[model samples]
Target chain A: MIITRRTFVKAAAASGAALVLPGTAPGAPPAPVMRAVPSSGEMLPAVGLGTWITFNVGDDPVLRDECAEVIAAFFAAGGRMIDSSPMYGSSQPAIGYGLEKLGRPEALFSAEKVWTSSAADGPAQIEQSRRFWGVPRFDLVQVHNLVAWETHLETLFAMKADGRIRYVGITTSEGRRHDLFEQIMRAHPLDFVQFTYNVVDREAEERLLPLAAERGMAVIVNRPFRQGALTRQLQGETLPAWAAEIGAGTWAQFILKFILSHPSVTVAIPATTRVDHVRENVTAATGPLPDASMRDRMAAYVRDL
Target chain B: MSEWWTYRLEDFLLFSPRVYWRLFELNNAASWPLHLLTLAAGLAIVLLALRRPPGHGLWVAFILAALFAFVGWSFLWSRYAAINWAIAYVAPAFGLQALLLAIGGAARGSLAFDRRDIAGRLGLLIAVVGLVVYPLMPLLFGRPWSSAEVFGIAPDPTAIVALGVLLAASGGLVPLLFAIPLLWLLLSGLTLHAMGDSQAWLPLLAAAITVAALALRRIAR
Candidate 1:
């Protein structure tokens, strides 16, 4: 029986079954939700691993090994994209350590950034980041926080033209400079755009989200848990009764599902140091997402808290 | 683009409290047995300060200079820089403090201790805190004992001890010596505060006490 994504989503929604896509071995766990990149139609898992502060383990072999374990578990749970930046201190090296430890998984989707303030240094920083991840080329290279965006975007676009990187994009976080972020998105033909958006921080819903959808740019949501502050705040609070309808067993999933449920979001990168949390974050993409009404209710419930 | 004022202290902190403390633990592990000598050195400085021999002040300054140099190289540059890119820039300030201590010790032979003064007594107490109480902070905070930041090894306690010793001393250059250590205390205090650690106020409190002692000495004079 030929199984299409639409039919599978319909079957899962109707029967309330696990989201195990076709071609999986019998009895295997459900696969994570995958969304297509708007430019190339390349399907990427909706839940990616973020290495902002969590993976900046420095040169500590023990902590580096622990990060490798998180990566191992992240891949084991069907996660693909792993995002990091040079601005994140030793995070890139720690990711290199993890990739080397994991023997460089084939399913890896490496997303890196060129973060230097000097425009001339953009290509060199990209090369250094590529070496750090041990990947030949990044799937996406963003101009981090929109620093030196004009020159770096030109360099990134050139790299994309040369097939050095699969995608070119820009990012901003903490809701800083939304006007500038939107201006760049409007001006440039970006393949991806990353910014902060969570259940409570819904400011992106105003313009950026819609702009991304209108321009066919893939959206990678950062700070899905406000760097774990959101989950910590909601900890010990009972999960809403209707959360189960969307298969959100934990608040991590509830928040991630809310981000992923947004039609424009291509991925939500929630960082964690624990193997269990990585597994939990990946499983968030496996379950049925909240519909528009349920999404509103989830937001309202968290906002009320 | 000049909207730098919008950023908060928490925004600059890239690592969590867990990672920050782990750096001390790892530094302690990497520099074992040396901690014993550093601790002994700290005690020796305190004993020498108490004795106040004709030239003991120079000895105290020399010891503090060595400790500052060691922490600058070992902890700030070697270990903490791995996690915090900003520390690489701050490490040179530690070297500058060390140089000032050495130069001041050689040039004026000032920094003589007078336990009779209120500032001197408070300075000795602060030094003792840096040596004993600062290390015990891990235990109080429910962290592993291995992560205890030691004097002469960890930057925070080393700066505290240096500030304390500088406070106890009498010298024209003593105030100059206070600059780097006090700046470091402020930076680390801000860092800890950003991490939401309950003990965040310790360094800041230590700095404030040093400033108060300096004021008290000024008033007494």
Candidate 2:
């Protein structure tokens, strides 16, 4: 039986489903969903914060403090991982300011990337990023977009071996160069692999996701909202009543839930500027995730819309 | 992987529109009353261009040189470079523009305006827009006055005013002056476009008009 939108809404209403907004529940919030790294079994909160365009606020004191509030709100909402890159302009320094402002939460998972084309510059750049973040060491360091990957990956691997870093991985975004990404995954023993994987852009489901699963590599999904394009498209559309079943109150959560529902996805790093959005994104990890059929339905609903 | 073609313009943009505009607000706040002087200087250039006074070219170039130096240090190096790494590389080009204006226009006295020509008239109009109209863009777009990019202090208006003045002037170095401002306009336009800004076309349109005016001037000559 095909479930149309009307039938789904009617059924959900009849069932008296309660729409639970993130961090707005009457009682205590549910424990955030944590997924284990396939390589080391180290658990990470499923919904992480991405510091891309959102945190590159430069030296504007007001915007920097706003970013700090976002960090405070994220940690308060049970988020652990915060991903950034040197290519993301002032984001590293902004993160440093935020972390310093927040007194440095112990549960923070610092994930950064090495993006220089020169192999020799990798270590220096990583050290600079460390200084920018004011962190002793990063939890994960990835080769950004596979630039100078061979040398950077070797350097990261050495860092991991020397315990300078916890995990070594690689990242690609906007679904570019997946062929080379697959080759690297096949060859190297990477701890993580990050790329774009959202409800709208599911190209990863065919090969990369399976490859990560097969190779026991944790997957970090980027651009889960296509860098806000998806949400803008879905804005003002009535949330499907069945979204309550998966505990998604806002569209941000609904989209994040779809990405997290995938078994291979270890984390989805959604970048946001607003403190409320950071809270909303973190809550996506706490709720009941959609099963295989529901995941399909969610994707279909988005596609049809 | 040498797959540079795979990258989109959005990939290179690392800041949001809010942050981008805030840079101007912060710059304006830091250089508060300095904007009045810069705008006054810009207006002076427009008036000078319109009147075609003797030796006004030297004064115009000197003022533009001063403005370029100020914007290069204040806006590009001090503020924008904090968020955009590429601006650091481009700031030196602005310095080069300042030096060129000083040597070619102020020192050599090569720049001279001919209001009798169509190019000069068009150039004067562009100068007026850069001086009088560009700052009003914020009001037109519903942004606060604090975020308005003004001449001499901000890179966009400064570049636009320089382009307009260069088009009006006739000199061996006039063509050379076109390169940096045009390039800056392209870069700024692309950056604003990537941010999904409604005013992205402003710089692009200015560049197109400048190029067309130059072409028409050449054809008429």
Candidate No. with top DockQ:
2
> Clash pairs of candidate 2?
none
Minimum summed lDDT over a 10-residue window in model 2 chain B is located at: B107-116
Reference-based lDDT, residue A45, model 1:
85
Tell me how far candidate 2 lies from the true structure as C-alpha RMSD in angstroms: 5.6
Report the lDDT of model 1 for residue B84. 94
lDDT tens digits, residues B43-84, model 2?
898888778788888888889988898899999999999899
At residue A254, what lDDT does model 2 achieve? 94
TM-score of each: 0.93, 0.93
Show pairs that collide, candidate 1: none
Best by lDDT: 2
